[model samples]
Target: MASWSEAVEAAVRRHVAAAGSPFTRQALIDAELDAIVADVGSAGATPHQTLSRELQHLRDMGLLEFFAPGVYRWAGSLDEPMRAGTSKGVFVVGSHSIYQDEPERFYRFGPQWLPNASRIAGNWIIYQEPRRAGPRGYYAVAKVERIVPDPATEGMYLAVIEPGSYLELGRDVAFQFDGKAVERGLLNPDGRLNNGRAVQSIRTISDEDFNRIVGLGLIEDEDLLPRVDDPMPARVQEEHIPWEGPVDRATMLVSRTVRDRQFRKRVLDVYDCRCALTGMKLINGGGRAEAQAAHIKSVAAGGPDRVTNGIALSGTVHWMFDRGLISLSDEGAILLSRKINDIEGVSKLIYPNGRARLPGGVSRPDARYLEWHRRECFHA
Candidate 1:
């Protein structure tokens, strides 16, 4: 069995890997102290003191670096390419239609950035929308699996995204906060902005700055929580002020606790708690919708958590949809699989028009995801 100190170090490693680098002592304690105490069953030094001692020991072993009096940055290895001193990067994108960018699958780039993108392969990267291109600033995160030449476009390459690693930010992060650039790497030594670096299609990101952006982008929003049949409020106010100190809230970005909540909220809100297939809206006494958020591609299949990849479905309909008993076309036509035993009963549960009741505008399901469901999940 591992010693108490070894067990604590192991727990600490898990937290750092999930949360990314640059964490505070208090945040570390809050995230892992209870688990350590439960596992160790009372140490002479107290679980809190034991954690503190191990943190300093890890720092002395060159696995962590002190960022401030109370803050620590992870210096240990998380994986092969994410080891200490390995550089990550950012990928600048425009409208998906314009660049043929598939945010969940791959990023398209020109030969100019081939070298820069190569450096960050096998690591994580942030997706940004250029100022004049669109409103979203730092919008999402993904891990790059590899860099491959784009067969469709000459002199271009695609950064193949790691399966299931792409996650849209809970909130779009601004380029600057309180007159200071969030990406300090874009600022010159004299504090003037570097126009060249600012516009680069791909650029290296310091771990400190990367953690800061991830912390801001993943902060939970109560307004995005799941609601019943109520329409979402017209305007939800947000604060753009970025944290100027240690970044401690980075891990939950990839946590299912955060992603599932945001996904359910966005999906149900757009559908107005009505089943897309049956047009039935059922609310419980607590005012929660009976409809559940069903993913078209599913997380296990490398689908993103974006609303466009989700649908609101009654519990029975969701089960049928998941098991290939039913599916949908790009045009929202309901497709019934021959494998379904009670086709007549299933047919009665659908809308009279035999089409999905999709939300208006951009909230509707994407043709790519719908096509994926039809080709990959549908029995017919």
Candidate 2:
């Protein structure tokens, strides 16, 4: 068994390796620090306390430094996240050079920037006018399709941003927002954007905003876009509605989008981003969940778009559930159909006790939903 420090280090390494951002304290806990603690001995305190102590210990050894309140950066870090070939976050760009407003395409910023540079793509734009300008916070989010030399100016790098939701800065900068960053507002008390230096060359947005905006197709996902009353957008343009293909199809599409967003968040929150049955928390390089939210009952059979109506599952289990090849008992035990056999190594994925771990949260696997699955959906 590894030592306690070694175990924590291993977990931290796993987190850093898998994540596009720096490892965070909560991330370490989510990465199974408790199991790491258990491997050595009983924790003298709660897992959080123990992990805190260990992380501080690592800090004292100069292996890491606190990047934010709960975020930690590994020592000698090389801005690994920025070099990921593509990044999704807000960036501050000055207005003077190559920023076309009419047919907004290519833009440039920070040829003189010492710390920040070009990443892969998918960068959001938050246009910052010179200090105390009216109608501040105008944004034209974009995707960097190609990086080329600035045609208008030779010294700067030009970013060709894809067409996205664009609104001018006539006036009105106060934002009504939520989550951690939103709670405090995007601008610091002195009217500068948070998460940057005094001059503010580039600013990384909160993860909440980054994920939502990027997921919504760089501002095109109008239905899922942040509901902001921008005074700058043309009134008729804002009022215009895109034509829906057909009523039933449109209904299905809207339901699907809502369900996809809401169900995934709720179910994943319950299991802490792990499969309820297998305890697998597969994540991509971006540290985003690879798990799927599955309906206990088929949507075609009247399954509701609800947390209680769903479960967080891995891809394979999701497929199996849809086919009635696997299901859940009324008591929340995992019930795999006999169709799964050792010949396929499918049995190995099953829990030894043939039970699923019930996640602790507001909404749970509703017994009614489970019964519906067992009756109509399950092959058994």
Candidate 3:
């Protein structure tokens, strides 16, 4: 009969050994308790109840965090020396559940983890809905392959991670938890809806459940929230200003209005309701959906402020592409500059094989823009 603290310490050690490293609570269940229960006489211990109690105790001590439902790991163990030869453990966890009333909006929970320190990942769960499509109950996981700050919106950042990583993490968590942790909602079984319609109404533990769990010491509160900043008012490109000559202020204002509207519509129609580069769809007013029109060729470069020269892009990708950090080929393939690829983890931006999605009616990219990108922007 081991004491409670002694039993917990021993179980933690055994669980870590079996997992080959520190792992979440589910890992403990999968690797140790399930088998330990069946093998009675060797250790002659009640491993299941003992491990659960010990985990609860640890949670109360503020040393662990529940990143998602039933998923947890060490939360405050930094300051100790890094384990020999191991990269500093850093991971990003994003979880989403859908609402029944407003299917477009998704409740998102994301937290960053540092192997032994306070989880540094942003904590605030934001309500973001897909822009192009309604809530379809699909979810993904990816590493934070890139983080780009928004120039127009202070404190707003864009993150690009491997899509495959997102899918893999979703699958792994689903498999390990036997669907208890993730609820993808009821499928129609008739398969009546389109491909994206598979996820109708996914639900997870509610906010109350989340707070209760946290209160019980099941998770940590880092108080990190998604920062939202309003976009700056649109401005004419600096180069386009005729500063050397006497300016017709009234004429300029009228000309700008017509051009801006034309550009906006063309970009919207060309993107066909989503970002051309990232495939981010738009949602209505609910902070959950987003889609913004973008210019493929700079307005400052004599590109017509019309659909023929515009593209629809998600707000984030638009900023990057406009800055010449990302581009598309004439055939709608992704093009990354050699300089971009040189950055750590930038390969994730390649999108598997350089594929790009264009609107059905729009012609291929203009040769002039493609040439310009190649000459001035393409890393080559």
Candidate 4:
């Protein structure tokens, strides 16, 4: 008993939810043409014309963005079933998981999540590790550049992480606070959790809820590190206070102030506050670290704000490294550029073994980024 337009809208939603967005007009026809062909029976309008009309309806409703003559991008939230210019979402990541998740690089997901994933394209996502996975709860956040089919595996897709956007939370936030579910969307009428919502690997998050998580995760600790350009070193003390105020999600994620704070925290934690080149752990009388976190590939060059793309260095060494006077090999060997006028002075600053001190595992500097520095910035 549905009208032709109603049936067309239903079919289109199903097709897009399953197939994802940024799709061509022909692709939609191919997936949904036959499903609603009956709706146009005995009418002068062809099924193709009917589908096109409904697509235009969706565009007018602000659910779709027309990119060209035939291409369209879905700009609606799949979970909430609403339209918006941008949407925020959550990604459930597990340690040693089945899906390939490079916390700072990309996230791999199956076809079932295409709709939810598309909702957050070109937007931010909060990364959480389930209790079963590890101690880190809502551990980090990153932006999704785009969604593309995984070349290595059929039916799988990758949400490419935006460069210089990934940042580990200053501290892990627990799922429940005072035995109440933190995510309001997951709470049932009786104050119990809707387990069905909790199990989803990809889900949309309300902006208010997203902001709350950011506040809890990135609360300033007493021992905050100084920014790269700070004239004076941070004075540290032994105190930690939980943030109990509202945070504007946009300001927290997009502002340079928060990005630098989160980036510095991740890099320093990875290297244990030691200079990678000289193996020095210098702390001033007030307890502020003299070791500075340097971008292996800088932000200006589209480098990611990830531990893999960062290295800790002393003040003088950081200046030299930033100026193309020094670099690092994939294997952690120091590479001094020909531009250095005082080789002996620089030599004394480096480790005696002539290798940069690097941590093992995923925290090590990524070779691709190091290669970029050698190719684009390093003098020789």
Estimate TM-scores for all models. Answer: 0.62, 0.35, 0.32, 0.70
- How do the residues 4-66 of candidate 2 rate in per-residue lDDT, one tens digit apiece? 665565456546645735677877787666556543344555767777888898789776789
Model 1 — TM-score against the truth?
Answer: 0.62
Which parts of model 4 have CA positions greater than 4 angstroms off?
Answer: 1-86, 95-106, 131-133, 145-154, 160-163, 219-223, 227-247
Instruction: Show how many residue pairs clash in every candidate, following the order shown.
Output: 1, 2, 19, 1
Please give the range of 10 consecutive residues that has the lowest summed lDDT in model 4: 232-241
Best prediction by TM-score: 4
Looking at model 3, residue 347 earns an lDDT score of: 46
Expressed as tens digits, the lDDT of each residue in 150-176 for candidate 1 is 889875678898877777766778888
What ranking emerges by lDDT with the best candidate at the front?
A: 4, 1, 2, 3
Off-target runs (Cα >4 Å) in candidate 1 are 1-85, 96-98, 131-134, 178-180, 188-193, 219-254, 269-273, 281-288, 338-348, 359-363
Candidate closer to the true structure by TM-score (higher is better), 2 or 3: 2
In candidate 1, what residue range of length 10 has the lowest lDDT sum? 78-87
Question: 208-267 in candidate 4: lDDT tens per residue?
Answer: 778878877884653555743566434222234489775567566765556666777788
Each model's Cα RMSD? 15.9, 25.1, 23.3, 10.0
Q: Model 3, 175-217: lDDT tens per residue?
A: 1123332221212233222222222111112233222222221
What is the TM-score of candidate 2?
0.35
lDDT score at residue 33, model 4, on the 0-100 scale: 64
